[model samples]
Target: MNQVIELIQSHRSIRKYKDTPLTNEQVETIIQSAQMASSSNHMQAYSVIGVTDPNVKKRLAILAGNQVYVERCPLFLVWCADLHRLKVACSLQDTEMVAGTTENFIVATVDTALAAQNAAIAAESMGLGIVYIGGIRNNPKEVAKLLHLPELVYPVFGMCVGMPDHDPGQRPRLPLELIYHENRYDPEKAKKGIEEYDQMMRRYYLNRTHHSRDTTWSKEMAAIMRQPNRKHLRSFLEGQGFRLE
Candidate 1:
């Protein structure tokens, strides 16, 4: 297998890190890898802000559902889905842009996520560890305030990057048979696969994390669906100027 393939296969979310700092060259290399990712229509509607200040890291940690790793990592990068620059350009020319629409928002978000994943893969190839913090969405408005983001921009997610001080066991994923379908979709086959994978995930999590009881993946997912934790996401997105319709 190619080196990148091997890296991709072995990738895991790392939460611990050594106190070592990344060299300037290594940082630049990772950023360049992110920049090289394919953009939707070559709009490049994204930006990455590297946060190094201790105070800022602490605030981000609090905002990110108290994920302490955000403060511990040597480098914290907040990737943004940005249409602000293009909007400003158009405005300067006395033109109107429809970047505030739902379609444009989806494109920018997808573009940012693709670039961030590329950066993650590149870092893993170089023996660096990384984790993506989705909790940046927990308080999007506050996060935007903290980042000083302008209108037409939203923080897609935050990434913590550093050399590993500890190697956590790889988390199990659903079997390929469950996820990949052939020409036709088979609900029964997929359900069976999920059942088997849920058992495997229970064992994996019980052995890996701090939880006392084994929680099957299907059960957890079902519970989340029932809880409606993210029911406000649509309203939040609308408040951020993203028109879902």
Candidate 2:
């Protein structure tokens, strides 16, 4: 395989980071690479807030379910789905802009995700470790207030980036047969693949945790699906002016 493919396959979520901060040149390169990611209609409906302030990071860490990594990481980037800029663009032309439709919301969110993934890849290429903090969504309203987000804009997620302090081995993913389909989905193949993967994951968890924990992927997924998570996000989005109609 080529180096890029190998790099992509070797990806891991890093939780621990060294005390070293990212150089200004490194930060600039990563952000510029993110900006090059493809966007819907070239709208580039996203914004990234790079946080280096210790005080702000501390508050964000608490808001994100006390994920200490948020505060510890040398650089924390909040990727946002932004429509406020588009609203202004319309105003500049003396035109009315439909602020929050379902399609627009989807587009903006997708754009933000795509850009953030590019940034992640860029950081990895530079030997910097990074982790995406979805817990930021746990208290979206508080996060928005802290970041001073304007109307028609919302935080999509946060990324913590810095030098690696630990090497957490990569987690195994589902087999290709389960996810890849020819013409139509093959349920039988997928079923068999999932069963095999469950056993693999059970062993993985056991080994990774030194026998402290032994759980199958299916079991973990079941636990996750048993309850509604972040139910407040719907109301929170509406309050942020994303009608999602």
Q: What TM-score goes with each of the models? A: 0.94, 0.98
Task: Pick the lDDT winner.
Answer: 2
Worst 10-residue stretch by lDDT in candidate 2?
185-194
Q: Model 2 segments beyond 4 Å from truth?
A: none
How many clashing pairs in candidate 2?
A: 0
Name the top TM-score candidate.
Answer: 2
lDDT of 2 at 211: 99
Clashes of each: 0, 0
Task: List candidate 1 stretches off by more than 4 Å.
Answer: 209-211
Clashes (candidate 1) = 0
- Per-residue lDDT of candidate 1, residues 1-245 (tens digit): 99767789899899999989988998999999999999988898899999989999999999989999999999999999988888887899999987657789889999999999999998988899999999988888888899998877888899999999887788888888877889988788867788898889888888776667789999989987876674666776776677766
Which 10 consecutive residues of model 1 have the lowest summed lDDT? 227-236
